[model samples]
Target: MNRARHHRRARAFPLAMLLAACAVAPPVSARVQPADAPADATKASVASEIRAGVSGKLKDFYGPRGYWPLWVEKDAIGPQADALLALIASVDVDGLAPRDYDPRGLQRLIEEADASPTPKALARADLALSKAFAALVADMRRPARGIGMRYLDPEVEPRDPDPSGLLRAAAVTPSLTDYIQTAGWMSPFYMRLRTARADYRARWGDLPGITVPEGVKLRPGGNTPEIALLRHRLGLAQGAAYDRALAARVRAFQSDHGLAADGIAGGQTISALNRGPAYYDQQLALNMERARLLPGPWVRHVVVDAASARLWYYSKGALDGTMKVVAGARESQTPMMAGMIRYATLNPYWNIPPDLVQSRVAPKILKGASLKGMHYEALADWSANPAPLAQSEVDWGSVAAGRSEVRVRQLPGGDNAMGRVKFMFPNDLGIYLHDTPSRDLFAKPARHFSNGCVRLEDAQRLGRWFFGKQPVADGSAPEQHQPLPQPVPVYLTYLTAVPTAQGVQFLPDVYGRDGD
Candidate 1:
């Protein structure tokens, strides 16, 4: 595929509209209730509650909207809102918002946003809500087991959800169960079902051996067609029956696709395999919600779809340069929100976080030797790591009493892990995009591999885009701190569906998040 083709397609407003979601819904004021001020106050209260319940489950069930008119009498969904709510809430969630009103507004807004242009003028807001209700209802009821994050029953993989499919399916299928599974060949949905819940080992079999086809053995010593296919994806060597190469490829694919790439095919990979094709459409829907929350003219900025594990840049409607990224690791998952670049560090100091160094990194160090290619720092005193934790020096028995502190930096060059440079973006969280020595990870369809911080595709290119005009000598700072000559913006938003050159691209929702 011509990278430019996709680059151009992604730049296309309609295409980008598919797999991206920016949470741009305007916050409603307490006073400005909809025109239909509580026709049946009690019923309105119940309906609002149901809407909230449903939106709480399916992260981006509704697309994007300024407001929803679910309260309008026209929707058939009014009667069965509870049913839809149950189905959506069936999906797993890593965390949930405690607030009640948030989900209600969010679900309605998503439905309203994805509604047809015809939907906007309809006399029935209930019809729109009902449509959303129906679609999600069908998603959970599918006869086939889901094969992505969690496996479902056997069945037909829905055809790729195109623009029109989104409309028709929107009225029928709801949870995107069919979208992630059957949508094949240049299908973006392959990326959407990637998720690693806590229990892959116990529930499902080994992860690497998973295959839709029959006769594939997952044992490390066996080389089967399934293994070869997986190996090919990972850029590993193919050895007739038992290709050692397939292990890495399977691991990478599993990692990228949000499977537990233990070189085994467990329940998670199966669920990822069988997800609905419209997952990308869902991504588009989700991103549209996110976009409504963004400041427009998103020029000269990086977009990291945490859901898809893909990064994008829009400079005059084009990617700054092509460099795929490895996002947050499953445990240190990336968040769903927006942030922008402020400054970057070239050969910058690595300030390891306290909690991570203590709990995760230090233990690995205590293993006494590096595992595989991982690196760590050693210090006689525990004070070296510069994070503001309450204590220091881990006491094996009272690990809690130990302070979360460890100073470690992977040096620049080949083994630097972070590669030659990093791009710094500002958010309440200490997250940013940077180049990684692990370029190999990018080839996988799903890429969740980092400690919360986003690993960008191209460091130099991102630097130029963010601070290209700024000047530098000793690298204190770029002189060109002024805004871009044309003032560009980068939007790092979450999305499941995004339009592509061929059609819409559905991606995996790596973070098993529920709610829109």
Candidate 2:
């Protein structure tokens, strides 16, 4: 071969080597990108999917939008999308927005998926929503007919709405259950729905308080906010077929939770009851913990679903007894833990927490001086009265009182504020389950009251069980406040999802604690 031909052959050989290397070399780039590079992927795709489905839903439910789904792109969907996306960011979900998230070269999260709570819940919610919609679509299939059909059932009986069960259904499913088991649904929207529903049922159902307020339109499944306020005020969401039984029970609950005993669903009564479902779930989780505590041959014991604002004393695997109780007010949430009541207190002292004294009690004493109603003792001097300023001495005749350093306390007795007796199951919170002189509060459909203690109904019966009452009334009550050899340990817990009393009852969450 000539010199020129040899040179050409060498050049061709080098080109062939370059091609081979390109084909076999391992990749060095660790960035995540689409086969088709960036182009408003997150916003465009997610919005397209959500809007297409959600728009149809809004149109179908509210009728041609009727000015409801109007401006959905710029107005409606935008806000919801932003909230959902912000939540996604909080969960550290992949592809969170660049404006707020950093594009760090971290390996993709694997089973660590188990550790992150928010993402797990969001994923569960998305899956459940998808599954439920699919089921509904299947339920209302075409049958080889035309387009979609079946509007919201107007003929459907307008009973109290119950969405907690809906949420429970989704959470209990094997796939979504993981989220339920760990974090649980606690968004403020859920609480709003829960409390709003309970409020209407308690207020609107009353006959005497029935002036039919505006915005009180009754829906098919649950009560509206206006409806709840009405029923709660009217004393209408009265009772079921067991009114007689419940009335006596209501009186008992009122006595237990510190409400007036008028057998009416007044503000106090409603406040003492209508807690949302989150509270009860806490109760369930705690009970599950208690179940864990008694790993031995534990047959019978009284269980207080404090978060559910109810109690069950069991013997021989049956509900031998039950009670209606009011739990901690929103500010002083009940603690979560386990304990056993070795005894019950006949009369109890209402120790005022420093926060309550400084915030609420002081303001009330300064303004209207209503200590007689709640049986409060204006502490003339908590710390030796550095300059004791009781409401009496501070001449309310002239003074902007929201600023005064007022302190108060209530002694224990029949009207001693804690009522006749208290069931003890001590926990770290310094909170307990007890009785109250004001018993009417339990009549309302919802309950959220007290600084952070639980008031019990038929305390004497609760007393009986702890005292070793024989035959432990399986369906009635264990026994009323009776003889006690030693003090019983009482635990005041905060739980909202409960499955007792009337079987899976939902409560109102007045304290606005869904954020927690």
Candidate 3:
């Protein structure tokens, strides 16, 4: 019930020794070398091969330091290597393939080092360790190509690694996993979602499919073929008949699917019931892939899940509040991107997009609609000529036909489309969070009503959260652009399956983004 409270507990930091260890690890050059082997002889040969096999920016990572061994030291596997091996092996718990990070090769090298105890054996492990470490880092921060460009593409900066710095920390960190967990390993939310995956995999891993009769519907007390199938599908007691218990299950099922919690199995509910475990597994996997794309963690941030039509505010690495939001419709789906909220505009002007001007307003003006209490100017005049133009002076036909351009802006007031406030973040797509006149839309189960911008039900509250001051209701003359004391990162994500206090809630994939 208290989602924010639960989030705080989930994101609590690990032990203090862990933090100190990460801070105290010595630089790569200062690390101790094997006693018998000269540092320049075989180390140079192994480092050269590592440069060839590692390739790319990573190959040059050790060029300045003469390609020193990262994982092995003193003719054996060191603390850093042992810690990295364990972390790579546990990647599966985060929905990542451990093999992709070369756990098998790392294990074999460790075995060889234990048997031979030679500088050559140690060198081989060092090379594999460096390559696997680089691969893990890359996979953690960068998303797959298909998922990144699925919607309005995000401007994601490639994670430029500091190989020496990371190696230094790995050497001293008490737990390498904990030290790197918040870096680029995975999003904190992904850790929470993994619990849901584990729960489903344990209970319904081998569930069979349920077939709902095409034309039949099952209500609380109905006796249809579909009802019998549902009872069996849910795995109720073999001889037990459908009754109040069955109704409770149906209501619970509806709640999980983001539908009205009425004790009825309608077409939508039946359709969901018909899906087997494979469908859920695929959904979980796809969402996990999506989570892998996030670059890194932010101490304070805002995360908007367009699939669920909700925004969660995270302050100081914990969920502080949640608000309902209206996202872009299916046709013009909201994009998945991350940006920082730099400033808030009070009583903001709604500069209508060109597409809206041509599609919605030009036709209305042609039909003799009065442009009362709004500002209008030709786009050409604003840029080149600088002259005022009356609504009647412009040719609506020319504007609609793309022969001419006009700029339509709505003055801030009660009826303005952008409500009273808007949050601005610089991005190429020009999409941002703003208040809406259609406040009632937030009450709907699915709030996909915007064109491309996000409509917040609690925009004023968000303003207070960002600036520590709320906007005034009166339509002031000078628009206020207040800078936030601390800019907060905002991530717009598309996740269909997320864990909650009760269980995992499966949201409708409004954009049909789930590739499966």
Give all TM-scores, in the order shown: 0.39, 0.35, 0.66
**Lowest-sum lDDT 10-residue window in model 2:** 1-10
Per-model C-alpha lDDT, please?
0.42, 0.40, 0.67
The digit string of per-residue lDDT tens for model 3 on 319-387 reads 678899999999878898878788878887777877878887888778777566344334444442346
Task: Write model 2 residue lDDT over 1-516, tens digit each, in one string.
Answer: 001110001111233433432332211221124642222222222223333344333323322212112111211121222332223333211112332322121101111212331222222323333333223222211122221111122321122323333333332333342332221232221222233334333432232432334422232234345444534433545422323443454454355333556554445554445433334334333333322222111135444444467766544323467778776666665544445554455545566776666666656656666666776655555563335344566533222344444455575545666666666554556666676777887775555576667677666677667675531222322223433564433323333433332233334445443334
lDDT of 1 at 355: 68
lDDT of 3 at 101: 79
Ranked by TM-score, top first: 3, 1, 2
Checking candidate 3 for backbone clashes, the offending pairs are none
Error of 1 at 276 (Å): 9.1
RMSD of each: 18.3, 23.6, 9.8
Answer with 1 or 3, whichever has the higher lDDT.
3
Question: Model 2, residue 203: what's the lDDT?
Answer: 32
